[model samples]
Target: MQHVRVYTDACLLFVEHKVSWDDARKSCRSFGGDLVMIKDSAKQKFILDSLIFEHWNTQNIWIGATDKAKEGDWRWIDGSQVTYGNFANGQGNNHNTRRFIFSDGSNEDCALIRRSDGGLWHDYPCAFGLGSLGYHYTYACEFTRSGYGTTIGPTNQTGSTDISNHTSSMAPITSTIETMAPSTANPNIETPAPTTAMPNVETPAPTTMANIETPAPTTLPNSETPAATMSNIIGKKRRL
Candidate 1:
């Protein structure tokens, strides 16, 4: 195993170590970090320049980048998809293969880099058993910005100014939060019935008419004259 230290003042990231791919990853994780991913040419160069000339015998070191979660969907272990990588010429040809081999005979899927006499990037495979520079591995590796720095924040030292500026440049979100309130504060109100009252029934009076009778006159008075008397007698006979 071989170990080396690399630092960047601008990014405040420190990378150090050379261990087996597994051990290197474990070491980074033990410190609550992970192997570094070189996102740009500048960063790649910085790592390369930091290494000693002899260390460049290999092509590169295993990085904390892989697509093991989903085949062909290459991404870092932190769930970040790789937008930039430092693959050598005709490298990454074995797309479906699990192992990544550099120009050197070392077999590893991930690795870091340092420059050789020719000013070209070289790969250093992660070794498990050998011990060098406090790292029990032959290949040198680096830790990500979060892994190396004391404070785990954005790699940019401008205090996320880029993100803020981008937010200001873009249009604001149009969506608004809609708060719904009950139509009435009290839900117990009941509707009133119709105002018209029902009609009352009246009983008819009983019939009160009674039967009546008139007694016939018992007698008729006789007249003073004879004729009158005769008329009275006839009237009496008629009555009887």
Candidate 2:
């Protein structure tokens, strides 16, 4: 349930449901606050008196103080040391046996306010009794009043810090543009294939044997002078 009360410098939210200490703190943070931190006696009294008025029948309510970081070195959720404390008699010793272990073997690391003990503090198992142990109680949340507009109230549909109407200038954009798409240009250059065929023009070289051989001898008759010379010489001798 969404119920909140405003005091001097803080706003307290009382969640009337059972949850683990961690889950309780997370719920409070979801609404921009955290589990109530009772740092000093004045804050402690404010919490207790407020719980009394809440009328929550349960005796336990998760607080912000814990020793989860280091055993026996208790500190609030904000990392401030617990200089002031109102732990019940023999309470902050982790457990009854003082071995820092509960009956279920879980460590007592989270703090809570017990209404039965008039809002005194105790270190309890952070996750025990949340499940089968059947231990159930509610938790309270506190938001600093100074952070009212920027970090308070449930989230809205328009995603603005303010609760009522989101300012038009602060309204979130409906669509987003992609600025990192893959490039369409190719990364490698294309190379042409090499030609394999010989050239079309032939060389002037004559490869035939007949064209290269010498001319054959001519069989024409001998010249007439060789034969006439012999006959003419015989006829002249007889006449003489």
Candidate 3:
């Protein structure tokens, strides 16, 4: 999600979500710039062509311009001059509407790019909530041309910066591109798979019961037989 588009002077953070103009400015301020300031048409064209939702699909971004301070006095939140505007054909008209009521009955005064139109700058009340009139807008962040050269993520899509937690230098790093569909070939280069067959292995057999042998029985001689002969001789002497 750490996507940022890099350039020589500044970087554009493409946050493709429903963000209010106020929250959008806060998000940009967290990155060191309070919303992008389109000083001229060149900057505006750069933002329109380079910094956005890839197909950017009618999803507008909130700029730093707002007339909340004084109606029709649309000025940059950083107190810069309001030199140029790329407002839509019918937008930025006499209605310099000051009173605002969000969908949830909230009030805000800010500006936004019209995604439904051609990314034209439009004066809008800053609020996106759940109600009959709730409207949410996507936003982009800008970092003033700093020599630190630090940039947001490749495209700033799904990426965020926590200013309070960071202690490192704000130097921009190399750019990052969004992940595309996995490709089998690049510049028509295809990776070949290894076709080598593995060596054959033998399986062992199962074990069973073992065989045994029995020994023959043996007998010993007796000693009482001699007494029988002495008895026979005594009987003969008696007969004599």
Candidate 4:
């Protein structure tokens, strides 16, 4: 069960479950997408407007972005290059925010959008379980929307799993991805087209016939030789 919004070819579902960053991502992926990746201002604004002040301004939400791959380089779980962000000024990887900095001195690199910062983004440790300040935060999940029509579910207050999927069941999201990311680096590059396969051909074998037996010719020349010899012998006897 989940709540969602369909915008253009994309769908963003606000999952109310209280899971860790990793678990939140897993739950989003369970619906055929990863955590919502807010790629551009338009997308970010869409999320903010959709959430409104009451839902977001008072809380934080997760996005499918992280610098866990390499400290400064953020990436989307869909393997997309980071290109757009709404990071609060001085936010993102290793800025001067204590919330972003862990006392344990581990990496705090997962991304989320906060209502406190006008729904702008902030980075926290991926392991930072539930909410921003030890409170549970609702998360958004992105999905492709080709065959899946756009839909919006009822609001979930407790972030529970009471909302079931309306457009589709737990079907595979193979034809879609809607996570947002930001980078000066090229983002959303299309994968190379797959090579086409050729058809097979067959050749016929040469024809072969079984061997046949032939009858032998009789000897006709012996008749002429014997008749000639008999005439000669008769002539010789008369002469004698």
Off by over 4 Å in 2: 93-106, 128-135, 149-240
- Each candidate's TM vs. the true structure? 0.39, 0.55, 0.53, 0.55
In order, candidate lDDTs are 0.44, 0.67, 0.60, 0.64
Q: Among these predicted structures, which one has the highest lDDT?
A: 2
Supply the global lDDT for candidate 1: 0.44
Better of 2 and 4 by TM-score: 2
lDDT of 1 by residue, 75-191 (tens): 666778767765554333233332223222223334344233333322233343322122233333344433343433222111221221121111112224457975866677688
Off by over 4 Å in 3: 51-53, 96-108, 128-132, 145-171, 174-240
Arrange candidates by TM-score, descending: 2, 4, 3, 1
Model 1 ranges with Cα > 4 A deviation: 1-18, 53-59, 93-108, 111-240
Best by TM-score: 2
Deviation of model 1 at 90, angstroms = 3.5
Model 4 TM-score, 2 decimals: 0.55
Off by more than 4 A, model 4: 53-58, 100-106, 128-135, 147-240
Count of backbone collisions within predicted model 3: 14
Report the number of backbone clashes for model 1.
18
Q: Of the pair 3 and 4, which is ahead by lDDT?
A: 4
